[model samples]
Target: MSTSTSADPRERILILGAAGRDFHDFNVLYRDEPRCEVVAFTATQIPDIDGRTYPPALAGPLYPHGIPIVDESGLESLIARERVDTVVLAYSDLAHTQVMHLASRVVAAGADFVVPGAHRTTLRSRRPVIAVTAVRTGVGKSQTTRHVATLVQSMGLRVVAVRHPMPYGDLAAQACQRFETPEDLVRHDCTIEEREEYEPHIDAGVVVYAGVDYGAILREAEAEADVVLWDGGNNDLPFYVPDLHIVLADPLRPGDEAAYHPGEANVRMADLVIIAKCDSATAEDIAAVEASVQALNPGAEVLRCDSPVTLDDPAAVTGRRVVVVEDGPTLTHGSMSFGAGVVGARDAGASAIVDPTPFAVGALADTYERYPNARGILPAMGYGQGQTRDLEATIRAMVDAGVVDAVVSGTPIDLTRVLTVDVPLVRARYSLREQAPGRLQAALRRALGR
Candidate 1:
């Protein structure tokens, strides 16, 4: 909880991460600070990212050799071995109680635990920033960000979306990446998760910037923009301070606005609160979320946004048993039973929804074991090449068994882009449609002063 600076010479530090915020904090706070030394980073939440180095190119001049990234399971041993002075938690979407449990472990290990100050870690942007965040993952933050970018562009302002870090691949090579076209995604070797976030923005003709170093990423985005839009990841705060902070809440999962970590912080700091999926949730659930938001941050302007799921071709899955593949993080960490794929499948008149549990292979099998809520629907868990193969194999096993006739993909990116599926892959596309249209435009005008 403390962000105080200590002048202790060579204060050895270890960062607890899931490969995203941990890298950003180091880049902004410790990369250039001469008094502190980042001994190592511990990884969790994300798979296969540990056992790698942060790479010297992005570690700055302070570290001639890059820092080691280890498994968080070895926290105590590493802390004692390195004589660590501080341990920083840099990931998001954790329960407040779980955060404290990690803190307790660090304290018991004779190391100080710190959560970096949002202000200290956030970089200042030369251009005005409008951030779109959520209280949890899969609360329609992606569609909301697209809507914000499109609105800003309608005003003849060049807006570049700066996404939160998901640097699961090569750390040094992804130091500062700019994606202007679809080719950029392939050029950078983006994973399905990264593509799911980036491709939609690119399709909208909005340039997206994401990498390990947010300060450098901000500088690059600001050079060609009049406004910067922060597309936050996993309910984390923006890397750049925003002039207008828009936080989203999911009516489908009411009370999540107050339940998760940093999500509560986002609601407390919001300039506007948008309750997403109003059409899908019951009126009672919607009212509950609205009431919670009012109690938490009464000053924030409240609005409703309807997220409608539509399939590219309904006939493909009509009257057939099909396997549904939903967004990875949404089902696993977001703790959702189903997603747009399920809705779209039922809407398309699918006879039955095939549970991909028995057919799951490799990492896909491990995912089902870890998150039982994801039993019926397959989560698109492609963090690396091996996982991607597992996803493809899982789907193939389902199709080969002659149990399912089609595949319903609810992920933002096209499944055909990454995987080769033999059966007809029906795409489920969802977007934000404001209930009170001109109200959001009016708010945007006020925020930009245009």
Candidate 2:
């Protein structure tokens, strides 16, 4: 490994990310710093994200040719080749041990490893911000955020939600996106994962903003809002400094609150700890999660909520052999075995839950190999056009073999909108129902003041 220092006075940096947080961190901290030159970004988690450039338009004037995104497996080589002075980790949903392992590798390769301080990177918002995050992915953050938005609107305040970045395609075009109608999603050519998060907000008549440059996104969102709602992604903390920080912990994954990297940090900083899915989780599990929360943040107000799962067309799945498709991020990186589709199927007395493994194709097959935790059911892993096609093919293969009679889709958005499957696609929905109804509103009043 070459260790010779660069002749230039500026420090060379390499950002390790899964596509979302890395760009935001660079834009916020180093874009115009003049002392740091970002040599490259290493990509992981999402597929087909590598081998692309950050695009000069969004990279600012310093990087005229733009920065290259290489595969994460080449981290050590890139560090040596670029003589990187610092390596910054800007991803989410990783265990503490996993983070340490990466740190050790960076140090061994003769580069400094840095996890940027959460507070240092967070931008101050002019509008009163209410941030809804989770101890891990699939902890019902979307439902909780929507509920908070409704509460703010009920007080006669105009509210706008800003989602965490998921700019998988065209960084320049996705610098700052606003979604007010279904047509906006089409105009942007949104993937299933993008639609899953943005469509629900649009359906509820709330305007949503997302994309690469959060500083630009925030300015636009703040202008139209009495309150800014930060809808966090993948167990990550909010990008904006929040007046009310509400963190959701899942009872199903009881001890996970203390196990993950930034997730545990979120627990410690939360103003309110919401134990979601009380109806689905057993009493013992619920108590275990609550005990962990109390141990972490004794001052935080804890509340229980039910995640009631229901099927839009129960008859489509009631007596049929069905293939259940759940939210991708929840199953793959979120590390959950099943989602609402499985629960709704069993509740509706489906004949049998067909295993989709045998019918997996291309990217879908690769996903199963990577995340062995996702079993029996299929994860809706559509990050790009090819992955979406693979998902469609895998489902059709199951139907062609006559293994399943219908499809149970538990994704937040309607799957029929994107895929044209041969079988009847039943939509399974889950929503947040607070156990102590008035408590959340009461807390909101205390934080925001009616």
lDDT for model 1 comes to 0.91
Clashes of 1: 0
Candidate 1 per-residue C-alpha lDDT over 1-450 given as tens digits, one digit per residue, 9 for 90 to 100: 113245546888999998888988998899999888998999888888989998889888878888888999989998888788999989999888888999999999999999888898888888999999899988999889998888899999999999988898888889899999999999999999999999999999999999888888988999999999999999898888889999999999998899888898899999999999998999999999999999999999999989999999999989999999999999988999899999999988999999999999999889988889999999999898788899999999988999999999999999898999889999999989999988777888898998
Model 1, TM vs. native: 0.97
Expressed as tens digits, the lDDT of each residue in 1-450 for candidate 2 is 223256878888999998899999999989998889999999998898999999889999988888999999988888888889899999999999999999999999999999999887899999999999999999999888888888889999989999999999999999999999999999999999999999999999899999999999999999999999999999997899999999999999999999997899999999999999999999999999999999999999999999999999998888899999999999998999999999999999999999999999988899999999987889999898888899999999998898999999989998888988999999898888999898988888888877
Give the Å error, residue 18, model 2. 1.1
Would you list the clashing residue pairs of candidate 1?
Answer: none
Q: Whole-model lDDT, candidate 2?
A: 0.92
Off by over 4 Å in 1: 1-8
Q: Candidate 2: where is the Cα deviation over 4 Å? A: 1-5
On a 0 to 100 scale, what is the lDDT of residue 259 in model 1?
A: 86
RMSD of each: 2.9, 1.7
lDDT of each: 0.91, 0.92
